[model samples]
Target: MNLEPMAGFLTFWAWWVAALVLAAVETVAPGAFMLWLGIAAGLTGFVTLATGLGWEGQLAVFAILAIVSVLWGRKWAKRHQGSGPSSVSRRADQLPGRAVVLVEPILHGTGRAELDDTVWLVTGPDAPAGTVMRIVRTEGATLIVEHIG
Candidate 1:
């Protein structure tokens, strides 16, 4: 079968299939790399259908698009690093600055306190019962605290 006349159709279909496969992989594994490549492949398939490029040219276009997409993704990731908290996600890190009465005196830098009905292992200077302290930060499962007065 002479595929010469049908070259454009074949190339477009091949890239379309590749794009779908890559997109599915990205959806399942979610490494962020495959999504860009899938987008590139989809664009390449469109370009091949419109321009009727030969195999070599189609491959080149796909490769170039893949590289460009990957580079753009990296640049975007770097720019958005640690931007802010998401509304959909939980905010366990927002406990700092919340005032809580020390349930037990902090001795040798370790004690216990109750916050929001949860008992937390606290670390700070020694104080007697009923001393108020502010949460400084959390270290692992322990809450670091400081005396308020």
Candidate 2:
């Protein structure tokens, strides 16, 4: 068998090069989807080098790996996906469900509050300074404060 050509890939090096390039692009892209193809390509490269496979077999491996990788990634994400600000990697964790005192006295208008020495943009009805307020919700870095009246 002529080892110089494996389908469109010229020897195993072609697949190797393609896999490497895809892996690098995956880093720049930073997603599980592309990583799958990169891995599959790398695997195909090694397989090409290790064994003599026809184009049909190579294509079969590629398709199987792609489908499996994507499905695995999706399931992994689904199992790990979370709800609320707890999963969020930010300071938003310190705001939700916390008690705050009206520093500027919100009276039927917007105002701000400080919790744990952190200032948060708030929206609520009229209230005076020193009134106890609770953070009901958070919206895009803003806190939805409600007067505990």
lDDT of 2 at 43: 81
Best by TM-score: 1
Looking at model 2, the pairs that clash are 106-127, 107-126, 108-126
Top-scoring candidate (lDDT)? 1
* Local distance difference test, each candidate: 0.86, 0.75
Query: Taking the tens digit of each residue's C-alpha lDDT, what string does model 2 give over 35-87?
Result: 77877877887787677676778878878887887788778777787433454
Worst 10-residue stretch by lDDT in candidate 1?
A: 82-91
Q: For residues 1-149, what per-residue lDDT tens digits would candidate 1 score against the true structure? A: 98765889888899999999999999888558998999899999999999999888988999999999999988887688645556445345778899878788888888888888888889998877678899988887788899886
**Residue 118 CA error for candidate 1 (Å)?**
1.8
Shift in Å, residue 142, candidate 1: 2.7
Residue pairs with backbone atoms closer than 3 Å in model 1 (clashes): none
Candidate 1 local lDDT, residue 122: 91
TM-score attained by model 1 = 0.78
